[model samples]
Target: MSNKIKEREIQIERLQNNLSPIRKIAGWTAEVLGDKIGVTKQTISNLENKKTPMNFTQYIAIRSVLDYEISNNKENEVLPKVVALLLDCDDELDEADYSKVQDVVGTVAATAAGGTSTDKLDTVFDVLIKTLPFVVPIIGTIIGTSANWSKKLFK
Candidate 1:
């Protein structure tokens, strides 16, 4: 083969490697991704496995789909869970709830960074217990238990 052909093949392999993580993180099976990109399941698998080189149009289509899905998944899955955990919310969170959680987390992070005292940490823990009493027992159990004991319980 020509040098140009070998270089093109290398580029295709790199693209496949770079895009494979997005495909896995977005929870798309090869068949599903192929459907979105207007290709066969075997085509996606071949590209992902580096068994074949993708054409320019195929590369464009796959890139577009992966980009869209990556952004959407970050917003829809990761951000909401992080906000909900920080806020200790048992209910479904909306945009407003997310904003409130973000503000509170920012404030707490800033306070912690500013050499906040152990007393202040205690106060925050008190407030957390008051705000979500149901979490107190869970927290107590975690704090009181040994790692080996917990592992043995599960086993």
Candidate 2:
């Protein structure tokens, strides 16, 4: 590829990388975001994972849809806020807890989508319960919150 073409590809890859965490934090799946952006899930996946070339128009559309979703549903920002507070806590967290955070997100989402795995649900709650000392205070610090937020959510 020419130098200019290579530079453009780099820019596209950078844009896709930046958008991914925002999409996850906003609770959007590829299919859902693709639908909102007038593209297919494969297209979004290609852009995010395979460094597929995207033009300016596609970039704008993807960004606009994500921006709209985040602006309209500020509640979706809770996970990141809680995570930031967890990282700030004086107590040390087990290295395993970091990996379990991903599991908790996936398992909880699956449960919400009617997944029938009771065992997985139990595991998710177990991770949450383990993290309660770090999470509960941050949640309580947030207004309109209560300690009951952590109690047996899966039960």
Candidate 3:
């Protein structure tokens, strides 16, 4: 087999490993993600187990669903913890902090409503910058910012 093929296989294995935890973090069972991806539960399990390789289309579909859940807080079934944290100190918030919070909330809301466009890399960057004070680093890692989905978005 070609070295490029072998490297691609390794990358897919790594992606499968990473995807399992992200799916769990998003509160999605294999069955749930499978439904979203139009695949069977067994197929989802196989992918998660790294017993099967995911095609580019499957990766994109799964990433889209995960991104929606993260931005919308659907996984937690509540407002983002960052919002609650900001709210808890609302009385003491300075103008700057308040403005930052508002911007973050607006960005998240907009993204939830499908406000982001691939053509607008600036919008994505804006959202990322606004979310920096929150748990976005961890979230980004889980969702694989270096993955093809983000590369496509930034491209």
- Top lDDT: which candidate number? 3
Give lDDT tens digits, candidate 1, residues 1-155.
97655654544443565344335434456789899988889998888677887776775576566546634654333222222233223233455653444444444444444555535633543463445444444444433232222232224
* TM-score per candidate: 0.40, 0.43, 0.45
Model 2's lDDT to the true fold? 0.50
Candidates sorted on TM-score, descending: 3, 2, 1
Which should have the higher TM-score, number 1 or number 2?
A: 2
Could you give candidate 3's per-residue lDDT for residues 24-59 as a string of tens digits?
434457788899889999999888677877876776
Off by more than 4 A, model 2: 1-12, 78-155
Candidate 3: misplaced stretches above 4 Å? 1-13, 74-148, 152-154
Model 1 pairs whose backbones collide? none
Candidate 1: regions farther than 4 A off: 1-11, 76-155
| Residue 106 CA displacement from its true place in model 1, Å | 31
Instruction: Evaluate model 2: give its TM-score.
Output: 0.43
Instruction: Supply every candidate's count of residue pairs whose N, Cα or C atoms clash at under 3 angstroms.
Output: 0, 0, 0
Report RMSD (Å) for each prediction in the order shown: 19.5, 11.7, 13.8
Model 1: how far residue 134 lies from native, Å? 41
